[model samples]
Target: MTTALFPPAPVSTWLVPLDDTADGVVASLGLARPEGAPASWLDADERARAARLHDATDRHRWLVSHVALRLLLGAALEVHPSAVSVVREACPRCGGPHGRPALGPSAGRPLRFSLSRSGGHALIALRRGLDVGVDLETATAGTPSPAAPATDGLARWVRTEALLKSTGEGLTRDPDAVALRPTAPGVWSEHVEGDDAAGPELVGPAPTVADLALPSPLVAAVAGPGLDRARVRVHLPATAAA
Candidate 1:
């Protein structure tokens, strides 16, 4: 079994291998309602989106997840959290503007990140020069999303999610066309794209994915090209687990 990363002691910064603080990937898992997290940390648009969530818990979790994402990115870039700017790149499939979420022009251009939250828990991950994707699911969460559906189970589901997100072909790509082949324990190194077609990311080798060991009922995974699963680290409060 993999080691659980969530519910770690409340840590300020957990660094991965890097030349400076800005060079390495950072992944964090935390309770959605962190104490004293001000909604003002989010920009006007984020605050408005959070307010649109009908459920109180959903709204709170959305706020915390976005806040955590900005903070992590800001920390890596050595900027204030509020100074971070977010934008979405054009879709890889049709060149539409509603593609994967990305850093704006002023932010680190090569950095790629992904965020997923469920069951009042949030996971955020980012890496410089390499695209990264992450997914988290609670057992109570009924089914995998249709965008990246999995008939097998949770493990395969999250792994596939990381795959699609990393490729930046999200929602537009057909899931049935891509198949994962295992290369190591808890690791997937090969995926087949449909129609003999490849996206911008698919021009490279198949993405590598590793299942994350989270506390019970929470399954997670991260994917990227030539991913060093050991280097991905996450921090959480000690009291986060149910």
Candidate 2:
């Protein structure tokens, strides 16, 4: 991919071995208001969303989140930020408009991507010919319960979130309803479970899940069909990396 980016900043793309099928890349960026993003870059809807965030800090973070997202997407597609068109796919389970956001009518082969943000950072993931999902959660300051402290339970929760996003289920399925267990290093096995007359939790279709190597106070995971063996290239912006 070409490095034609806005603000003329250097971005790093780091590669690691993990793929059995779909090739992937993930870009990490700081959400603390980046340079070169004009208020005019946002449309009415985004502006409305930003307006809802009355706090100036929150508003700037939201704006920069979008700026980073557009920049990352633009780089992946090799187009101007304005040229990247995104459309929502129908929900796989409910057949509704509330589903994964994907690149629409763009150049080259259709690439699957996922975006996740937490605290002061964000992640954008792109994969070739495979559905992918990612989730990032900031650790709790004092006693982070489900998603903080980087405990086993927190890891389970993030995995559930990533899997749900991958399947376009979102919160429609309760996080507590999924059962997860570690099956390998930096990986977990999960299945949708429910009570039936036959048993307490019935095992169902499960997705490939793995933990991300982010720092403390920030836990993350990604899911897909073949992520158990995926080559996820994690990219850091050159400025932030230094």
Candidate 3:
């Protein structure tokens, strides 16, 4: 058997491309389609919301995110994927259930995770005892051209989004208000939290932020505790059974 790239304890990140054909072959991941997986796996409101997405790609991305999350959590918790519970907690500022998703009360562990997708890519970051957030963006013609004077702008955007996501506020918080400057090679530390902002932080210590290198035109970053010890593993569709 191929060596399994299991999620490490306490903290780690997984970068996966949503290229797996959704051909009803998630059995190796211990997932059950059972007709209403999306409607049932997602919270009621989210299910209805997902239904309103007119584009098939949008709908498919939603399904992959939720299903992948449950499967990962199930592997970590040693339970069947279908047995895992996910909750979209209320917005910290609005008290509405449209904020970041979290593991439900029955999960029995403080499994914090963040999900982000852009273009054809997706990223999932998880940590056991601290909050975590990840953002992925595929560079396109609209992004600052590599030769543009301010070429680092896209990286800054991902850093800000990752920081906001770590706080569970996500893009709901003004991206302009959060500032991240390069601290070192591959690392960008939070430099400012503008007005209408709280301090930049996660569940515990200041989160370590760093860019992730991928094989595509994607730029990814993650923010969370214990990240200095974190490892990123790429799991392709064929490796699910490993």
Which prediction has the highest TM-score against the true structure?
3
Residue-level lDDT tens digits of model 3 in 1-242 = 11143545554566554545443325434344444443355456556777899998887777666666766676677676667777788887789987888888998887788888775556787777788888887776555734223546777777778877887777677777666767677777666556446553345567667787776577778876545533544343335434
- For each of the candidates, give the backbone clash count: 0, 7, 0
lDDT computed for candidate 1: 0.64
Candidate 3, poorest ten consecutive residues by summed lDDT:
1-10
The better-scoring model by lDDT among 1 and 3 is 3
Using all chains and alpha carbons, the TM-scores for the candidates as numbered come to 0.75, 0.72, 0.77
Query: Among these predicted structures, which one has the highest lDDT?
Result: 3
After TM-score superposition, the amount by which residue 237's alpha carbon in candidate 2 deviates from its true location, in angstroms, is 3.8
Per-residue lDDT over 119-170 for candidate 2, one digit per residue giving the tens place of the 0 to 100 score: 6666656666667788877677556555434454676778888877776677
Pairs in clash, predicted candidate 2: 18-229, 18-230, 18-231, 19-229, 19-230, 19-231, 139-217
Angstrom error of the Cα, residue 231, model 3: value is 4.0
For each candidate in the order shown, give its overall lDDT on alpha carbons.
0.64, 0.60, 0.66
Tens-digit lDDT track for model 1 on 153-176? 667777778788888876577655
